[model samples]
Target chain A: MTLAPFEGADALVRRNNISSQGPEGAPAIVFGHGYGSSRQMWRLVAPQFVDDHRVVLFDHVGSGGSDRRAYDRGKYDSLHGYADDLLEICHALGLSEIVYVGHSVGAMIGCLAAIAEPTLFDSLVLVGGSARYINDEGYVGGFEADDVDALLDSLDANYLAWASTMAPVFMGNSDRPELTAELLDSFSKADQAVARQFARVTFLSDLRSDLSSVSTPTLVVQSTNDIVAPVVAGEFLRDSIPGSRLEVLEAEGHYVHVSDPEKLTTTIRSFLG
Target chain B: MNPGVQARDLFDLIPCGLISATTRGVITTVNDTFLAMVEKKREEVVGHHLIEHLTPGSRLYFETGFMPQLKAHGRASEVAFDLCLSSGETLSVFLNAVVDRERDGGTILFAVFDATLRRHYERELLAARRLAERSETRVTILQTATTAFGNAGSEEEVAHALADASRAATDAMAASVYLCDPSGGFSAPSSSGAAKQLVEAALLDALGGRGDPSPTGGLAQSPTTVVYSGSAELSAHFPSAAAALRTARVEALATVPLIDDGALGGILLASFGRPRRLDPPTVDLLESLAQQSVLVLQRIRLRELISYRSLHDPLTGLPNRHSLQRRLDQLLTGTHPNQPTIAVLFIDLDGFKSVNDRFGHLAGDSVLRRIGASLERAVRSGDMVGRLGGDEFLLICEDADEQSAGDLAERLRATVRNTPLEEATGLSVSASVGVSIYRPGTSPEKPTGDALIQLADEAMYQSKRTGKDRATIIRA
Candidate 1:
């Protein structure tokens, strides 16, 4: 009936799988990984801010080294659980007026965090984020509700099969060979039960209202030839959030962070400046 | 050697695949060794991100683990990734990289090692470990189900316990338990069941859509299991049921037959939120649970049957004299606040000796059976009707007054006269009826049922003395 009171820095780090670099007093740039990869998606882009800004990288509780025991089905059933982690990390580090960079589902998670505590973030960068994955009466999220169900069923197979079939599509950069492999390894890194729950939470979420509520300046990055979040999804995010700019990347796939980190860093930097 | 010869030699040979990439992770140079390993030329290897050649999982490893560590520490070592060779074969490679920083950004140096042999055993071990974990989980689930069945109190509870355990173990959305009733119908599904329409449809489909209500004989010999994945597969077997399941968005169903000593006792139905493949160990454990469930469930049913027979008339399936007395005793102890006078009736056949003496006891027995059925039909909804002995019957009616009791007694006297005995067609049959009403005001204390029955017997004798097929009433 009662939850343990939220612990500060040490507990937040353990719960959210947080890691950081750069000078302590500098402005913070919090980076969130999407479904497939962990904070490594920000490797090529994060180093750009290492000189003057603090680069904070953390995996969602189930994805990386975060304590799996802390994962309660009731708490993590919604995206708010993930967003709360972001806020906790900010408060723990005494970070104010930070930039939140989120990829795919993480974008919506960041938006949720910003809406809850708008003072913590000054700018939001969402790459390939979609408000809803399932197409409603007039939406195109590239999948039906049943398709995601089917995908979860497919994940019921062994890790090898899941890695082979899912990694390519999630990485989406077929022209490059290593990205898919990297994604597969990332998929294998997660606990089986956590991975399955993450898939359900990420694909089944509907967070359109959260976008409009984000008071921070936002940028929506749409990648060309993206299969997961199509051009319309980017447009939806931009249109839903007030005063938000939409940028189309030259890269492709759901993992724009892995495929086109340079473009992301450039666009995000320009928007923040 | 000339400078040109030295440069050409450097490009020709190396111990391992050597490659270099710009700070942006785009490959800008490749040696001959690197080209041969990927089975590509220098031009093909250059000007492309080395990320493209790796498998999806390895791509993830590079981006999430290897690349970040490489950037943070300025060096990454012993990174394993599977690369897609030009021949469509994926090669497992162990990579080590070092960043070389200069005036114009920095270049990344990489060394690749072939790790096919090491990786083969690692993958095999991983699969074996997973199988072991799966079996361990299944063992725990079976232990829980076995314990539940061993301690069950009733047939329905056993079904419920097993369904609850299995659904949680397998992560199923809903579960149902069904037992075959003797009259070619199944009992109402247990509480653990899913939505009515989906379960009904799935039950029908699982049984191959046969109209026969007795599912015991309906099961197929081979496989001993029926599994439907998704609506399409389920539709192929039971179209109507599949339609209902689809409407409920149920993706999978598995029906395991519960056979006790080779006889069908019942069935266990499991519904899933998504299509699933039933693993062998899971299927085996389910079958074991099915067998155990039926054994317990059948035992409960037999116990129930024994209890039923103890208090019910064998021939007519009505309450016997013992059950009727118990009913009256319970009624007296818990009499309602607005209790009406309780009436007890005694009826005796009048015609009897002539037909029995002429056509024999068998003919008289049929008449007795016919009269017994008629007595039951003549009583009110809450009345208790039972056979006392040869040619004698009793009725315990609640809320009956003197006028109503007399009217019921008249109805009882005419019941035998209305239908002639099947064997003795020429003979007419009738009964003498007597009623005793126990009004609470008649006595200060609660009245006993034995006194009322005694009074009713005397009243029946009075009716017999006056004229055979008539009614008499006595108020107590």
Candidate 2:
């Protein structure tokens, strides 16, 4: 059956490049992507929810198909700015009782939005999330201040490579050239300046104080051997947020949604029920 | 040439390091050049994550930035990283990699170039470019500040313009100008941005004299600009100020003293919210701003002094007769609803001629100066008191009628009587006071300032004829 992505899209939907599908008048499930990735990262997992819920996916500003001009450095200096954009998108679409599934930085964006408006979200699924990336006195955040600075340097060093990576990779599979092209196109559209600043904001931001205020039911999904967000970070998220549970996936790597989509989808489905 | 044999030889003998690794970055194979560059054995290199051989920063970049791009696009090129060698040194390397994909994962081939010379050159170029940009910003700030100061009519406006210009030049979170008072201490600062608390805390630290050594150090030894970058650096110099900054989440401070011609004109303070090591160029910009502001402030003060001398009595420092006439004309020209009547009180000292003859002209000048000060104190805030040459003084008041003006005239007569001639023993002074009242929209004819003064002089003669130490009132 044919699934119309933007059947009844509005201004916000067009601006954020939102793609929606599912039965009408169904409970909505929105997916937010993390740093270094966009809405395309949700490709393997989001479709599983379409049978029962209205699945919505959109790119954050300066990433994917979202309008790059909307990226204001002052406004997006903190994650709250991204939360404001998310709330605006949700309000424009008239979506409430939302099941928000966010990964990495997007997870904190969801948490912030949920804290600002508790009644709008029914639940939150945080994958590979950390409140703070830098290790404090007692916290094991898996990184240091110097590491974050190095990450910014890395961004500068890779600017040329990232800009030129738009060329499509057609090794052996020539039949599915369009799919590969679309993926690369969205990945290449991410503004380099925005990505650099976003990295700084994401790594330097400390949301430990804001976590205890979250009232929505949450599911912290973590992966084994995840370098960015370790198991301790997942446990911290679960303990800090009220009524939240932690689930450790048997997968390896930070991107659990991409590494093991079936397991991630099953866990999300179980949690929603 | 045999193709397979030539390719094998070329791979081992290549100048750059080459490696094959798993998608997860675990090295599976490495050429001879790669082993020689890292100064490691083949076994030590293989079966370890490629990130282990890289510096912390490059490792982070590879995983978080480069790896993701490589995974999505199947290739990445010209990515720079620093590889840690076994000899306790780093190799600045640029990599070009391609992934051979499988159903679930992939193997990757990486070509690494030693870019030590290139990286060094690039850093030099970047620093030069940044210096050029900062120089341009400094010039623009000075130009804008010069224009603003040239147009500034008052000291407060100059202070504001300097504050704004300094903040823009330094990219500070907040900037302020603390003017020097006559007592040689700084006055309350005129600020250009928010975070007044941060400025206040920093100002206290600056004025506390921790930075200045040898209390009597004159202009030559005075510190030009004192910059503290982080909490530790700030705490080392000013502990309490650092504590205050910690509470405000401020991390950097630069204090530039505005000095001109061996006198402390004022001070400029710039603060930052993030930990920042302000380079030498930024410090230079602060000093330049401070110098420009000092020159502008000097100009403003000089102009103010000249204007003050022109319209004021040199002996008593009271407004001269010319200034009084101009003020009276201005008051009479305006028309408004419920306008108050303007009253002019003219007074002539009764016994001043005898005191001048007895105690010399210096004593007479001292008595005039004392009376000028007393009259200035006696008048209302909006009233103007002026000396109209030799034993004559004028007082202008708004919102006064005939009865109130007569009362004020009597008070002035008493003030003159109570004047103690210190140099001449047993000598005292009194005044014959006259008042003229003018009501707007009520009088038959409007009188000019000279005519009004003449009428008051006639009334003063009437007071003198009747009795000394008395007042007379007349409506003009």
Tens-digit per-residue lDDT, A28-140, candidate 1: 89999887467766778899988888888888887655676777543455576788788888888777889999988899899988887888898999988888877878877
Per-residue lDDT of model 1, residues B275-383, tens digit only:
4557777777787777778778878878889999988887667788789789878878776546788999998888888789889998988878888888788788999
Off-target runs (Cα >4 Å) in candidate 2 are: A1-273, B1-48, B68-75, B86-89, B97-117, B120-123, B137-153, B180-188, B196-228, B231-247, B256-267, B336-338, B419-425, B442-446, B465-468
How many clashes in candidate 1? 30
Model 1, stretches more than 4 Å misplaced? A1-191, A196-249, A257-273, B1-50, B56-128, B147-159, B177-208, B212-223, B230-232, B238-246, B250-252, B258-269, B272-275, B353-357, B465-468
lDDT of 1 at B424: 86
Error of 2 at B222 (Å): 8.1
